[model samples]
Target: MAASGAAVLHRAVRANLTARALALVVVVLVLVISYATSLRIYFAQAHEIATTKAEIAQSQASIADLQSQITRWNDPAYVSAQARERLGWLVPGETGYTVVGADGKPLGGGLTLDSTPTDDPGQPQAMWWDRMWGSVKAADKPAVKKADPGKRAPVTPDSKPR
Candidate 1:
């Protein structure tokens, strides 16, 4: 009887030890998961902060570039040069000549004007008032739509064919 009682006591102690060890392991696992989540959040925020800072730096650089351009544009010499190059503007009393290619298009190294010459130089352009009156006449007339050759006109049962 004494031996049996000792055996039961030893088993109880082992079971208690195992329960305690399991509880400790569970607590450690929970703590590790919580710490990992916190670290992940911290890293994500750090990355976002770095990206924002980079964007701010890029914007500041662009602003500085625009400011420099503005400074350049404020100069009269730069404005004159831009006008001569871009618009082919000439100083007063100075004659300007444009070299025309065989195709009637102007040939130069400078920036080309957006407005191209008329296809036929001999054809006279209509006066502004004439164009306006023609546009008015056109607008007064109702729009006429042509029927599609591929499609047949719809026939109603009440209508008789002539």
Candidate 2:
């Protein structure tokens, strides 16, 4: 009986390989799960990169529009238009009439010109010094002495206006 039992134990040991196969399967499943997680992260980063690229393209288009506008403004006609609109510039022997509340449209009795100036009419006119120092910003203005005697009237007791 002891010899038969010993022989059975030896056979059982030779066929006991199920546990090792199960361990290998578990390892393979862990590795697959890790790989899938890494793939998910990579795809997410790709999506973010795409969105950022689209934003960059939009900003570049806006910059291009601004550059075109800047170039257009350098033209003489465009500059003249802006000046006439902003500074009330008119050709010689021409008139500039304002029709406030009309907005370049025909008034259908709801709005009419108030006869008053559309812009600040009573605003104090900028004096010669103010305009020279403010508007005509001649950075390269060389010091010029008054040469003509009449142009530089002397402020003395004997001097008088002509």
RMSD of each: 6.1, 18.9
lDDT of 2: 0.80
Per candidate, the number of residue pairs that clash is 0, 0
TM-score of 2: 0.48
Question: lDDT tens digits, residues 59-152, model 2?
Answer: 9999999999999999999988877766667778888675545467643333233676655788966768997886556666756976887887
Candidate 1 lDDT score relative to the true structure: 0.93
RMSD of 2: 18.9
User: Where does candidate 2 clash, by residue pair?
Assistant: none
Query: Per-residue lDDT for 1-162 in model 1, tens only?
Result: 999999999999999999999999999999999999999999999999999999999999999999999999999999999999888899999999989899998887776757766757787888899999999999999799897867966789987896
Each candidate structure's TM-score, on Cα atoms with residue i matched to residue i, is 0.63, 0.48
Error of 2 at 128 (Å): 20
Question: Candidate 1 at 41: error in angstroms?
Answer: 1.7
